[model samples]
Target: MQNEINIPIILASVRKIGDAFLKQYKQNTIPQSMDELLKQLEDIDVLCLTSLKKDLTATFFHMPWHIGDEFDTESQKESTIKGDYWLCDAMDGAIQYLQHIPGWTINLAFIRDGKPLFSVIYDPLATEMFWAKEGAGAYMNGKPLMVSKKTDLGVMLSVFEYGHQDKSTNQLNKEIGMTVTRLLDNFGIVRNYGPHGLQLAYVGAGRIDLFIQEDIDTYNWIAGMLIAKESGAEILNADGIPWQWGSESLLVARKSITEKYLEIKSLK
Candidate 1:
């Protein structure tokens, strides 16, 4: 599958879109408000999708931000095709981007016959791109990326977050809140970078050891999950089953850390 297309050229085109958006932001062309920035990102997404569509014949799927006047008519649901499908998150850390944070990323994954064939995650601020083809191993900035073998749960840096802020009445949030509270108390340190992609990328790079998020969306976790998996990280759904794109939740970490985390999750 790696030889099916020009990987270098396709990745370069993806990076170009990210670089252009970051350049415009550095030039102060992007507004500070979430509404304004999201509106602008929609336009950027169109440019990206257009460029990708021109280069590949795959069916594309992306978040429905209702970015442009032309976007209103587009279907918000995921699209399935007979050949290949592209899963993209044009701007991963929307909240971080709106807050002028430097941790957001851009993601793209190619799915063929229901399997993830390749993935690329771009961090424009750091000018680093992480990519992997199935069975080819992961890389960052052209260097190989590998997960840390640290198995100690107490010594590992962890990232965790729930989907909602109000946990008082939400059953799922309540359960997640309890789980995250205990994790924070037990793990070395905890964080939520407002973007799941960066968290997964960091785990792949061995910068972070654990990541757990409840009710995550498919587009947000798919690309990074593949990158992490290729880097030798373990990932599972809430039920401790193998991870899938539309799973109810995601728990990705080093092998030992994931085992202990799952044990704790089961007690609840």
Candidate 2:
């Protein structure tokens, strides 16, 4: 199935859609109320999804396609049944985009049996296109990506993402707080970026040394996981075990720093 796929063609289609969305994004004004913001978000989602579905279906009609937000509710139930399907987040960092921020991106991944085969993440504002193919390697704007070689925890920059508010629980809140506290105490710098996927890509590009998130939504990070993994970053769960599709938490760090990071995590 991987051999039959043409990543370049798929990337081209996604990039075209991303470019169009970027134009609309720039013209959009900030909503005055929460209700208004949500309404506009819905409209944008429909527009991006419609265009993506139409273009991708024209070329790869046989493969099924699922939107990122719907994956948890729909695909999780059908976990036993999987082949080749396209999973796309038409507008990653939707909040940032609506607010006219620069961190938004378009993310797409081809999954085979719950594992990413190939993926593309387009940062429209930065004009940076990140991609990865299983066993091939990760790249950004045609340049190969590599994780940072820094092994010292005190000098490493880390990132943490908060889970959706609707899914937040007391335990999750405590976990987030403790994690951030730990990062602040040890890491050189810590930040929470707009798009989760882009932060993972940043780790792959060696721009960030660590990325940890609890209660992760699989669809939002799966594409970036492959990119980071292919770029030689270590993908692990909070328990220090190797990461898999259904892990509730994620910790991505450079290969050179994994052991040291894990040791620090163990101290907690």
Strongest candidate by TM-score:
2
Q: Clash number for model 2?
A: 0
Against the true structure, what is every candidate's RMSD?
4.8, 2.2
Model 1 vs. true fold: TM: 0.82
lDDT of 1 by residue, 1-268 (tens): 3336457876887788778668665443456577887676666678767766565544223312222121221222233443566667767774566556677777877777556688888988889999888999999989999997886777788887555323455587666777678778779877776777777888999999988876645567777888899999988976678886446678888777788888886776
User: Model 2, 111-218: lDDT tens per residue?
Assistant: 888788899999877899999999999999999999998867777889988655345345888888888998898888889986888999999999999998876567
Q: Which ten residues in a row have the lowest lDDT in candidate 2?
A: 70-79
- TM-scores vs. true structure, each candidate: 0.82, 0.92
